[model samples]
Target chain A: MTADLHTLTGAYALDALSPEEAREFARHLTECDVCTHEVAELRETAARLALAVAEVPPAALRARVMAAIPEVRQLPPPGRVADVVPLRGRAWRQRLPYLALAACLVGAAVAGGVAVNAEHDVDRQRTQAEQQASDLASLMAAPDAAYHTTAVHGGGNATVVSSVSQARTAFVYRDLPKLAGSHVYELWYSRKGSMVPAGLVDSGRPSGTAVLAGAASGADGVGLTVEPHGGSKQPTTSPLMLVSIAG
Target chain B: MRAAAREEQPGAPRPGALETLLDRVSRGDRDAFESVYTAVAGSVLGLVRRVLRDPAQSEEVTQEVLIEVWRSAARFDPGQGSAMAWIMMLAHRRAVDRVRSAQASADREHKAAVRDHSPAFDEVSEQVERRLEREQVRRCLGQLTELQRESVTLAYYRGFTYRETADLLGAALGTVKTRLRDGLIRLRDCLGVSV
Candidate 1:
């Protein structure tokens, strides 16, 4: 009689719900314990996201936005309003950004921390994501672990099958997406030979050949990670892929 | 600036200044544009900075948003909503565009690489008391449930789409929307913003 947790989780956090469904469930929220707890988790998540954004424009931006409005055509001037009653509240105060901007910024970053999931298919997005997390975590946990890369879908559409070469002791990605504009896939061999970084890969998918120092051939397979428009000389974060030459 | 900490504040939400000036600017009312510029440029700028992480890009988007405010001012219908919401919408859209343009990684990844990003929300929160709109937002957020408050703030300030919020929190999307709506309603009540 009861919907499962995934259904509730997906429905609440992802809002994959239809309009009617959202309204129907919303009515139930007042009585549903399942709904209340889940909603809280989602809200906290939301706050962190806002924190991710770092920019805060000065008041001057608003002045520019307002100065551009044409009251004569849109409505009478403020003094000769047709409908509005020229109401500006007393609580209203204007000065400059203070400590609140800083606190909200923290809240936003944590909320926005989850950027984008590489996959969109419901099944893959839900289950594969969990498995990938575990796999990455296990690899990262290894004391002797070297550099790693998380599997990335190439070209935004193509599937980069991340498979292991059990015999050769490395991982290989097939169907890598084509590079775009100034962006290219960079491969990093681990630093200290323990998952630091190796190097970069050219547009080697679909046709061209690409290489990663293959130095991790004995340790953990070289990992492929995304950097800036141009690849970074050193690894900035963990790789998207982690394959043992024999993995 | 805080000298008037005890004095009553003025003109927090002025009505109808934007559209009139925008229309004039569209019709070559250079002086009107400047006046409108003087009125809400600060709001637009603050909103833009809150959304876009890159300053150069923020300035660039701000320029485009302002230009669009002028160029598209004719399409604005004051009857439907206040001119303020319309401006916020434009600024919001531009900021969203900038966020999307960045390569999205998992939320946890950024948590560790947090050092790479610019000012944190905590820092912004600290400076907010000095801001007019931020103060309004704080009062409004206070009305929401802890969950609802967080949900709405994340959506607007962090520039997250609903789905991202779900994944990060491991919660349902429907919950995210409900909380957002709840929080927004509370905020609207507090700030008296129509939308």
Candidate 2:
């Protein structure tokens, strides 16, 4: 007489069955959604039991694990790497709507009298701007990156490339009025009603980029406000630009 | 900055935070890997210790399991299970492999010596029973009949195959199988774990 395969569920869940028996159960599992769900739940329960018994590990273990990490090779991310195409060539130009919007802001900046002075300085700024563009292109190319463009309250506009999965954000701005003395543009990530400082951006440049150390996953949106040079711990002025990051 | 963020929560880690960190770890983020290690190492060590009953051996197995996590993190699919589950599954398998190999005879001898020196079984059972009262899963495990619990604990926490569990518990293979099934069913219900 054949043994009932149903009796093997617990054994299978706990991984106690012999390899031959496990193979038999695997065959049975394909046709049985009930068994599949049951096994999943039982395994989760087993895992919880493991979690419940958690004790403090040796303090030295952390140091050991951290020390070993760099020596170990990480698995390559699954799927084609080419699927994440870098923003280059035609792809770069395709974001021209944003570029055009930024161009308008640049015109506004020139009108706002943000002094584009010496030819040498102009050439240096152009090089910096190109570098910033390339940086923004790479940020946009990241698989998790999302782009958002928002108009500055008065005239210009800003673009934010954020990746919650990467816990990083790139903020690019154009045509915004530069502040004099000890003043800078500060980025803030707003969640609910509270805002946290993300990073600081130079106010002198006609267009500039800044990478912030924060994740967009939980943030309601991003905001930009003028802060004292070296940046303020809190926003002392209203946001000049606000962009909703959440869908 | 991260230390300050962690200080706000103290020891209470957010649910699904490990999953998020593992995603980052898979992408080869060293900071996230360190955070994930700090978060889960305690539980990993605890499970390994419980199975091996040898602190030194458990530590070795725990290291191997964690190193495996680093190597194979890209294969982890959140759609299948929680990060803790995935990590513990690796820990359990490694711990079991350690205790089931030729080296296990030495472990068994060590356990025998410890058993000889230990107090009566009743005292150990009472202590275990008292400890079970504090945890939901342990409390559920307490509800199982003595034999069912023995069969399950032997096959599961002790990493014994059904045949080995039967030999250890001095029961037939069929009896061990049935008790394990019935015991797990009760555990699933008592824990309110949904299928």
Candidate 3:
């Protein structure tokens, strides 16, 4: 029997076509705007039909679904390449000078004793930053990574990428207002009800990643708060941003 | 039909509201997900229950569909359709998958029984419930001829392909396809769904 692709529009919209027929219709659809519009309308009708059957879900389902959200991971926003690449490139550019200065300090260690310790600190931090960048890259690529993007209280936005299975997380901040004085952005992990200190975040750059302690398995959510230069044992103020770790 | 009785009072939540919630959900907003769940879980579960005919399995599929919505919210395009439609489409797909997989397992257990019981009785009750639930949809569905309604319902609610639906109804494959297409066109028009 000769099959008219147009006749398959309803079956295609309902996803009732056989695999081969479905593929054939998909190919046909690209060349057939009329069929495409027809299919869209059919789908809308089907959706409305589906809506007619709305019965109240079990009461327990609400809590179950809500609890599951934190555990599920979200897809990264579009233009992920654009978001990640430039920041890494800019960081590399900024780090090159510091690396050069560190080398110069090593060379002039005999001239100034103080330069050696400062150079060591810089090297340590640079190594840490590199590790954090690598972690951020891996988290971004992880198929199971759950992401949450939230606006900071004062200004800017933060994207938190976490994997409960990996027990790791990375926070990316953009356009955060530079804090003056001894204040710093500190991270916290809230589990059940209590909050635990995670780490300090630097707000000096236009964009940067903050690597928090890898204990996502134990945490239900992540929060950021402004604290003294060194993080407080407990959050001394309200969170600047609170992101639920569930997807 | 129960659905026909309720047609005078359209009860579906505004599609625009769902669209806005979906946009927020795309931004990784957990609160929006909760709100969206509250808005659509019943409908999603109801659809799945109709297709699967097993409350336990339907619940599992519903959870999976909702989690998928959370994970793939970024892919939702408001330009294409309303969020409710996008969500319902997901529900239908997942439910169909469950139905097909269950059929596959039943075939493995008893291949002959699978053919003998193409569309189970429980499935029919679920379909009746579905029809009774939405008045406008029922009214629209009622517009289709008997052959058209059977072909469409077997293929859609029972998760049968056109060929399977044809086999179940003892009709030609081409005939089933034509009936489904015609039925859907009538339903779309009756429901006043715009292309």
The TM-score values for the models, in the order shown, are 0.39, 0.55, 0.53
The global Cα lDDT (0 to 1) of model 2 is: 0.63
- DockQ for every prediction shown: 0.03, 0.19, 0.18
Using lDDT as the measure, the top candidate is 3
DockQ of 1: 0.03
Candidate 3 is graded, for docking, as incorrect
Give chain B TM-scores in order.
Answer: 0.73, 0.76, 0.76
Writing each residue's lDDT as its tens digit, candidate 2 over B1-195 gives 122212223322221155545655676766556545644666677677778887667777888888889888877655455566678888887887787787774775486334121221111011111122126666888999998889888877778898898998899998999988888889878976653
Summarize candidate 1's per-residue lDDT along A119-238 as a digit string, tens digits.
Answer: 554565457435433443333212122222223534321111112221111222334666657555666443223443344444544322222333334442344655555455544444
> What does candidate 3's lDDT look like per residue over A1-247, in tens digits?
1248788889998889867878888888888878877877788778877777665566566557768888777886565431212222233235333433332333222221112365676788788877765665454433244545556889876666676545787776766888878677888776654566787786566456687964777675677777766566666666777665642
Q: For candidate 1, lDDT tens digit of each residue in B107-145?
A: 223442332323322111112122333344455567678
Query: Which fraction of the native contacts appears in each prediction?
Result: 0.03, 0.41, 0.46
Q: lDDT tens string, model 2, A84-181?
A: 21122123335434433432342222212133356876687567656544444444323334455556776666666565555556775656776777
Please give me the total number of clashing residue pairs in predicted model 2.
0
Ranking by lDDT: 3, 2, 1
The parts of candidate 1 lying over 4 Å away from their true place are A1-247, B1-16, B102-132
Whole-model Cα lDDT of every candidate shown, in order: 0.43, 0.63, 0.66
Tens digit of per-residue lDDT, candidate 3, span B86-128 = 8988999888876777564363334322222213222101111
Model 3: DockQ score: 0.18
